[model samples]
Target chain A: MNAVFQVNNLNKSFGGLTVANGISLSMEQGDRVALIGPNGAGKTTFINLVTGHMPPDSGSVALRGADITRLGPTARVRKGLVRSFQVTRLFSDMTPAEHVALAVLQRTGRSGRVFGNFGAMPDVMAEVSEGLKALGIDHIANHKVSEIAYGQQRLLEIALALALKPNVLLLDEPAAGVPQSDTSRIEEALAGLPDDLAVLMIDHDMDLVFRFARRVVVLAAGTIIFDGTPQDVAKDARVREAYLGNYANARSSV
Target chain B: MAIQRAIAAEGKVDAGPNWLLRDLMGLAAVLAVAGIGYLLFPNNLALLTRITAIALLVLSLDLVTGYCGIATLGHAALFGSGAYAAGIAAVHFDITDPFAMAAVGAVGGAAAGLLAGAIMLRGRGLAQLVLSIAIVYLFHETANKASNWTGGSDGLAGISPDPVFGIFGFDLWGRTAYVFGIAILAVVFVLLRLLVRSPFGMLCRGIREDPVRVSAMGASVNGTLLRMYAISGAVAGLGGALNAISTQVVGLDSLSFTTSAEALVMLVVGGTGSLFGALVGTLTFMWFEDFVSAINPFHWLTIIGALLIAVVLFAPNGLYGTATQLLHRVWNKR
Candidate 1:
């Protein structure tokens, strides 16, 4: 499998506490990888470093074999490496349609045009509606984002990332604040992504992780403990001791 | 590459609907008011013309502060710079053609905008606001110190503009000047209307909503804002040049702190983001001031202060913004 995205020996720290300690990973096109770790394991930091939200202390991130380590977040997004937030970051006053439409406009490179009503652009509108429909929130397209339920907001978060048409998509946490009943909708929407798109999801819910991820990577104390098939990750002695055992109990209660 | 190609191809298509129609209605309202003023108070045309120029200043302020969410109290620097540039061109360079003077004003204002934007955009919120105010003071002092060029604190004098298109002389009754000011205001209003409704305008709105999200969307938020600032400067400059031409004098009051504060007040009173609000706010404020001062010059400011307080309490969105919202609500219900 050709690695569409590669992270090599990334290191980052805040004060004396190391958040990412020489982490290295790669994802092939069409790969579905779940990164699971205990709290403060630096999962979000690692994602931030890769997506250009923060500069890694040492390491390189490459997309399609081109080095993107020094690029800013927006430049990286334009290179087709996109990320959704841990907590949904959205324009509170805008509608889902407007949010997706803006993304579509950015994708099409028409965001800088000083003339033309964006809502009237048929191609952009088509892509925006399609993105909303993909996330099962087309019915609420015209409703203001702040007026929507938290679950719908979370789904809209994914919808935003999808509209960017990223070659490598990083989801910080797709189901963090979503209700239990709405998890299925997120899962279903995630399930519908195209086969060739690479995705890396950082999630704490092991049941969802094990369900969605074909391969699971376990992180503990800012280091990778295991990387293998989901079943092997579930059974790994070190992973069980470091993280998964506690998750197993939490999953049963939930 | 594909994105670049799409932008190259699709960038020039007509932005849906007639955004100009909205601006046209606004211009029509201004012209109608001007016409009524001509009939009812023929002697007060000069005051009405001055209001037109100040309305342009307020409109320009709305672009940066209202639409782009740049907190500023230094916009007077741009206006004053424009006025001085036009006055200097007329007196020293003998380029008295009104259009030429306005162009000179636009260039001067754009330069000031570039300088101010470079310095002010480095910070956000209070830092930005304070820096903007400082820049205005710096420009004001610079103009004051250059006694020979700017006529110092005595104000620039000995300037006269050639007949607009070499025909319409700026008459004492201000018939020509009044029409000229309205004409410039109308053209600028139309252009700004198109600008604010366009895709670029949408990007600015997004930046105002959340700059981080806009940046994450692969946009250069600061760069876009800088461009908006320059455009806004040109508009304000045009207003200042119109003032210089009509009055044939440039004053230190143009660069004073009060001008900046008053322009901002007019913008907030009109509402921030909407162009029509800018016009409505300027006209209402100036006319109300004129009427009140005539009635009780000593206590006119108190009345003005009370009116501003009432606006804040009752029309939280400013008069025009609240009106637009109400109209939209009614239209949606129907």
Candidate 2:
């Protein structure tokens, strides 16, 4: 379990309200870790700081054992890190194929060429389709991003991130707002990623989290209350207290 | 990538069959009319030259507001700077050749664009717009103060754009002027057209749609935007240089807010996504401005304002895209 991302003594605040306070954790490559917490406990903020969405006030975020505390989101992705938004960020008018193609173009660095020469390139479209197929959304390649269902948009965004071939993928509430029927499929897909690819997710769905996460870091009040395997996290007294509801705690255990 | 490339390779826009043919024919017909107008209204050839020059400037606005998705109302600063560059060359160095002025103007405009891009790209949306507008005002102030070269209200005059081949001069009838401008327009339009259809073009569209996703995919939002801004400015500069040549005068009007607003309105009226839209917008705008002004000078404003409102309501995609969209819908309905 090589640590792919290591955060130490992290703190972030927006105009004096602390969003992430002194958070320290290490996520191994291929480790599915659910960062669970109440709605403003900085679950999203913490993930954002790690992915370079916003610079932290003070702390270090190391990827593959190298500190990237100051790297921007895009630069971090080049070092094998990628993230999807909490709200779906697909191009509403663009086809799904067009969405993935742009990602591939960025990674492959083919976008800068004069327009006259690029469409003739044979490999670009293949990569676009391959990415779509991997995410099981190739059937919707021609569909506009706006036309897709909420669940499919999530997968499409994931495919967009995957097109970059990042080593560490950040999924913020991968199952948030998704239908109950789609939860298991989403979970299985998350769990099926390459073992060497690291994933850290912020999901409120404890059942889905427990099923997919080998390790869990339960956040409360902008700090980690529990960091252990799913079973240990379920047994932690503080984790139970923080959830503060029988159904939630039971869902975590299951 | 391969399949998408295959889709793009055919240059088949879902806009439907014969669209390109229709577009090219339209281009040819419009150009031929102008070409014939050159021979017939040699007296108004100078005005036609002005139209060609404005087309290039409007095309630059198309790049920023259309392709890069940064709606700017301060682009006239770039146009003015370009005109000043050519003006200064004509006044100081006695360099009055249209090509030389174009070179200087493009460089000046590109420099302003690059600087503006760096300062504004990170600002995002409304910030970028406000910052750009501020920069234009700042430049306009500088131009006003530096009256020694720019001629203040009178503008830099007596600057003539020497005709190409040296054997000819800009005749009073504008025959030489028309030939010179038409040639430049042909090249600029073709190049911009090729650029907008390419992967670079697609990426710009992608950037406009979602810069966050674009950045995460490793496209440097700032860099792409910066280059785009500079390119747009250079085009504006070329237009300015050509304007200086055809009119044999440069005015403070080059930097006026009205210039920027009108070009933008023209872009919206014609459509942004298409270079043809830029050309169409510029032509329609100037044509209407001329026609309406001749009928009732004070009333032209109301007419133009109403036209803009109608465009927004009836064709939100603007003229070119809307027309194609409508055609597609009808075809599908059939």
Candidate 3:
């Protein structure tokens, strides 16, 4: 399989503390991958650096074999690498449909249009439908994002990235805010995604990480401890020690 | 496509009127009302004319402070520059045409916006506020020191704007001035209405709401903000030019911190995020200022300060914002 995304010798430091240290990984097209780590293991920071939310101290990220180290998030998104926020990053005032419509608008290569009469735009409704349907949110397209339930809002954020019609989707801790019962719902949505969309998700939930991801990459102390199949990662002594260490207390509280 | 209808069944249109038409109809209504108002009270026509000019000024402020979310207190500098440019052109260069005054106004405002935008881009929030205050004081002192051209502390006069379009000569009551001001205001409102609702406007709001996200989106969010500042300046400058032409005088008051503060209060009172809010705020404030002054001498400053504080604390959204929310609540109740 051809590699869709490649990260090389990534390192980032915030003040005196190192966040991502010499991290190297790759994602194959159609690969369902989980980036698992204990809290503060630099999973989110690594994702942020790849998506250009923050820059790596020294490293390179490539999408479709082309370098995107200096590209901004939107430009990176345009080139088919998009990531969702850990906390829902949505236009709260805007409806679910409007949120999707704006994403669709960006994908259309339209110039920045903060002030046009977008009401008359012909494809707006269609774009909203495509996005909402992807996440089974067609029923709440017109609802204000703020008015939606917490689980639904999380779904809406995923729908927003899906609306971008992205080739590669990066979901940062999708299951973080979801309740136990609703987690199954999120799992179902992840399971139902077509093979065409390659999703690189970061999760603290070991079950979803193991169940959904065909491949799992484990990080501990800002370094990749293991990158292999779920069974292989589960068997790895290093990953087990990282989680079975002080994380035993951390894991039980959740 | 059918899925969209299904989605629509879930939620209704939550926004107010469609943007472009709302502005056109709103401004047209303002002009019509002003015409009727000035016609009825010919004596107060001059004050009403000044109010219309203030409405325009507030509209410009809304662009910078409200929409773009840029805190600007030095806009008074741009307004003062426009007033000075128009006054000098008329008093010294023998160019008294209203059109010439408008051109000079636009250029003066654009220049301030460009200079200020370039510098302010490096500084946000309190830094911007400090820089803006400095600019205001700098211009005020410059105008105060330039005695010959600006008339120094006295202010430059002899504006003598020849009856707009060379028709219906300038009367003592300033009827012709009010009409011309209202007409130009109509045009400005329409142009601005279109510009603000455009994609560029949305981008501005996107940046205003979350600059970090905007920067990530591959757009130079700061660059876009800088452009917005320039546009705000040009529009505000034109508004000041109108004041100079209608009054036939340019005062150093244009550069005062009081002028900047008043503009802010007007924006908040009128509802900052929109054009009509600016109009309504200015009109209401002018009425209160003029009429209240008749009953008590120090009504304008005292009431405006109190009103601003009340609006900020109680209303939060100000007049138009509160009105919109109230309407939404009512609609939901029904």
Candidate 4:
């Protein structure tokens, strides 16, 4: 099977601090991969390099085998590469409906229309409604983002990414600041994503990583130390030494 | 069930009738105000016409600085370019038809917008603001140096536009000019209302809120802003063309730094990001300035400063913005 998303020899450094070091990764359609790492493991940096938010010092990124190493973040997104922020970055004054609607319009290249309201466009609104509903955020679609809960805002971020009709979705700590009670909603939303869409999630929650990921990739000090099934990840000596440590051993014992 | 709930939520927030009703009411209020001004200040139609022209300038300024969140203090560059273009067309090209002149002006303004957007959009915040200031000075100096065309500091005169459909002469009493200005303002206001509510407008609002996120959403931040800047230029140019027609003179003052600064001040006083606020601020500030200066010419600046301070302290959202917020609160209570 061909990989839908591919990264080759990605290398980045901020002066002496190397954020990404010769990283090569690929995912087939419908692959659920969790990127796990210790603090400053370059997880977010790797995502940034792939998404074209930051330039890689020496590497190439490709979506469906088409080279996009030099594309800007906006161009990358246009090519079906979409990402959500680690912290919920939402338009404070806009409602969830407006947020989703913008993504749909942008994805369809109808955002440049100088006349006509998005609300009046039945097709666009339908898609917006569907996207929000998928994430269980339809109830708060009309409420301003500032007025909504953090968990709902996080969900809206995912809904926004989904609205773009991404073939490969990169979620950066979607439930980072979400309360313990609100994490399940995020998990459900993650599970509800289209089965054929590839997802690479950067997360700290081990339970979420174990539950959502069929495959796990661990990064330590800017290098991929382990890449295999979740079942074998806990048993990898290097991953256990570098990141999982006792947690992996504890899970293995259970 | 989810789709039904979604539809119900949308209905509750923005029903078709509610939007239509609000637009109609807004249009009515603008016309009503125009009518009242016609009745109350018949002798001062020229002043009213001047107010109308400046109001357009402020409105255009709001599009870039307010809607796009681009900090620019030299928007008069667009306004002045429009005025000069219209003036030059009349003197050199013999395009004295008022509509034609307005078109010429709009084209000129848009071209200038493109130029300004290219330079200013390279940087943001304070850097953009400084670049804008530099741009206006450059335009002002260019107009000054090109004395043969722009009349140098003497100001360009002899802009006699053929009357509206060649029926109403631009009389000294300023009757036609005032009505013409109002009509144009009304049309632009309506079009801008549609524009601000459109998908492009939402994208701009998104850009304003967080440009990085908007870019992440696959919209080119610079491209969107440049388009808006050009649109803003067209609006301002239309106003300048009107000024050239009504007043029959295009001066270096049109492109002056003071003009740009005044437009910014008016926008702030009225509120940014709201079209109605632009009009309200322009009318209120100009009228107040006229009234206060007439009453106490020496101390008027002090009084205006006090008024600004008061508005900023009490209604930080500007007068119209605060009023609308209060109205919304009252509306929700009922």
Candidate 5:
């Protein structure tokens, strides 16, 4: 069976610094993987390379057995390879409803309609409501994104990614910058993601990572140092030296 | 649910049943204002007609710059192309019909837009601005060098448009021209109102704020922006044809750098995104210019400069945008 997402020897570099060095990874359907690394360990770079935001110097990224390395970011998204940014990238003046509505329209190929308003389309609105409600942000859907809290903004990002009905989701630090008090809300949203959808989340929070990931992949110096069950991830010697270090000991004890 | 209720309550949404009433009211408001202008400036109809044409140019600029965030200073390329196409059609091809000339102008403008959009959309921000400036110069030089068709720097002349539906003739008093210009403006204004409120408009708005995010949502940012540019070109072209038909002359000044810069200024002063703001800005700026220049021709430019500075400083969102914000606040307080 073809893996839902496969990356083969992905290589990228900026001048002398290599961001992705021969990174080979694959995920099966329903995989819930957490990608954790140090600040400069190229986690975000890997996501960028796979999602087609940045071109790979040498490698191939495939989804459902179809190679998509040459495709642009927009085309990759249309093929159901969607991602969320670490920093919440949203339309500030637009409402959450507008964002989700646009996503739904784009997904269904109706965003180019120059004559009709999305508000009048009952089917579109129904899906928008459902998506917002699923993220527990339906009540504030009508409010402008600028007026919403940062935590809610993060949730909106996830909501946007999910609206595409992606087969493989790459979430770049979904809970970053969100308050500790609001972290649970994000975790809840993460937990409630569709069961059969493959999710690859990059996060720094060990607790969230350990709780959410079925398998954890650790990267250090643009190379995958560990790829195993969360339990074994903390015990891996290379992972301890490169990333986990003292935290791995503490995490294993807990 | 509350979402449905909110959608319904939101005035900008739901372009279906309510749009007829809204559009009719908008049309009525525009005609009423035109009627007042006609009553007040019966003798200055030519000036009013010119304002109407420039207003259309500013409106088209708003679509790309204001809505899509594609900063351009070569919009006059599209406008001038329309004027030249209309003039050439009438003078050379014997297409004397005003409507047919407008159609030719629209096609001309759209072609310019496609060419300009392809080049401009390649680079963003300062690069995009520079490319637009370059394009306008190229177009200007091309127009100048093609003397036979464009009449060189002497300007394209001998453009005579047929009467509207074989009834109202293009007269010396500029009466028919002014009335025709207002009628066109009203119709275009109404259609644009619908265009900006549609899903496509929302997509452009999304692209304006965060194009990267829009792309992640599976939209081709350049493609969407290019399409908008073409539409903008068409509107500007229509205005150009109107000018050609009204004045029976097409000049090199229509394609000049100053025309593009002035259109940008008018759009900014009126406010960028709002169609109403475009009209308001054009009317306010042109009327103030005419009113002041007529009094003191030499110092008029300085006064206009001061007014622009004041508007940018106090009303950073442009006159219409700032006024609406204040009105909203006041209404909320009430």
Candidate 6:
């Protein structure tokens, strides 16, 4: 099977510290891959390198077999490789509808329209409403992003990434700061996403990782130590010692 | 059942183009002010005309600093470039047609904007602020040194623009200039109102809030901001051209730092983000200056400073922004 995304020999270093060390990975279409690791395992840096947020020291990234390593973040996004932020980067003064509408407008190549009222643009508004509804934030579409709860903003973060119509999505901790009670909503939103889209979610919540991901990749000391099915990840000794030991023991104790 | 009902209701409720109504009202208010100015200050039409020209400058400044969130104190560089361009075109080229001169001024201003935006965007926050100030000083010195073309410190003279469409001469009564200024202001205002409500405007607003997020959404933030600066320069150039045509001269003061600083103060006083706020701030500040200086001549600046401080404290969004918020609250209650 052809891979939709391929990373070959990516290397990134800050000073002498290697954040991404000769890492290589690949994802097929419709893959639900969870990247889990202990803190400072270079998961975020790897995501950054893949998404073109920063230039990797050495490596090449390919989307659909076309080289995209040198492309900027915006260019990568236009090529259908979109990412959500660990911290929701939303306009505080604008409403959720405006944020979603902006993404939809950019997706349709109409964000440059300077004459008509964007609110009056039918396609943009429809997408905005639909995107918001999908994230369960439709009721607060008119409210400013600042007025929404932190959990809602986190969901809006996912909603914005989805609005770009990404073929491959990189979600950087979608439920990072969300209260436990509110995480189910994020899960529901993720669960409802299209089946054909590839998603790589980096979340510290193991429950979310295990429940949502069919395949798991474990990063340890800037390298992938484990890559297999979620069931196999639980059984793998390296994954337990490196990252999943706490979750495995907790499950047994419970 | 409740969810279904809400969804059905949402479908029926159109967010419709409410801005069209706001635009019409804003135009009416502007025209009404012009009419009032004609009646009350027939003798002071020059000052009123000057206010109109400065209003355009402040409005243009709002586009870059307010909408695009590009901090600039060298905006007067664009204005000065336009003014000098129109003055030179009228003097050396004998291009006396007001419209043609305005067009020349616009081109000059846009060129200055493009150059300045490229240089200034390399820095952020404090560095950007310093760069903008440096650019303004550079423009000022260039205008001063190039005495032959720009008339140097002595100022450019002999700008004799023809009548409006060959029908009305720019008479001593200032009727033609006043009417011309108001008409141009109205057209520009309407265009800008439409622009700020458009997708491009929303993108600028997004850039203002967070450039990183805007880029992540597939926009080139620097390119968008550069385009915004050029458009702003064009608008300011039109204003500068109007100044040359109406005043019949261009002075070094056009490129001065004071002009840039005053424009920023006016924008802050009016409310930075809203076009109406720019106009309101210009009117309030200029009128206050004209009226108070006429009365107190020496201590007027102290009064103006006090007023600015009061505005910052009491009406944080400037006069129009604060007033609208108050009105909205009252209307909601009703």
Query: Which structure among the candidates has the greatest DockQ?
Result: 5
The DockQ-based order of candidates, best leading, equals 5, 4, 6, 2, 3, 1
Winner of 4 and 6 under DockQ: 4
Interface DockQ per candidate: 0.42, 0.46, 0.42, 0.60, 0.62, 0.52
- Model 6 TM: 0.95
Docking class of 2: acceptable
Q: Write the residue-wise lDDT of candidate 2 on B117-208 in tens digits.
A: 77767677798788878877788878888889888877888887776777678778777777777877777776777677666777788888
Chain B TM, every candidate: 0.93, 0.90, 0.91, 0.96, 0.96, 0.95
**What stretches of model 6 exceed 4 Å from their correct place?**
A244-254, B1-14
Which runs in model 3 stand beyond 4 Å of their true positions?
Answer: A14-16, A72-74, A192-194, A248-254, B1-25, B89-95, B145-151, B298-314
Error of 6 at B25 (Å): 0.7
Candidate 4 lDDT for residue B40: 97
Q: Residues A64-180, candidate 2: write the lDDT tens digits.
A: 888888888778988888987888877787777777777777788787765543334457667776777777877777777777888888888788888888878888887777788
* Per-residue lDDT of model 6, residues A153-182, tens digit only: 998998899999998999999998899999
Q: How many backbone clashes does candidate 2 have?
A: 10
Comparison by TM-score, 4 against 5, better one: 4
Q: Candidate 1 chain B, which ten residues in sequence have the lowest lDDT sum?
A: B6-15
DockQ, structure candidate 2 = 0.46
- Candidate 3, residues B74-99, lDDT tens digits: the string is 77777777778878888999888888
Instruction: State the displacement of the C-alpha of residue A18, model 5, in Å, after optimal TM-score superposition.
Output: 3.2
Where model 5 places Cα greater than 4 Å from the true spot, the runs are A14-16, A244-254, B1-3, B10-24
List each model's interface RMSD. 7.6, 4.0, 3.5, 2.2, 2.2, 4.2
lDDT of 3 at B279: 82
Better of 1 and 6 by lDDT: 6
Off by over 4 Å in 4: A244-254, B1-14
Native contact fraction per model: 0.62, 0.64, 0.49, 0.72, 0.77, 0.64
CA-based DockQ, model 5: 0.62
Candidate 2 versus the native: TM-score? 0.90
* Best candidate, TM-score: 4
Candidate 6 lDDT, tens digit per residue, B11-87? 32224435577789999999999999999999999999889989989999999988999888888999999999999
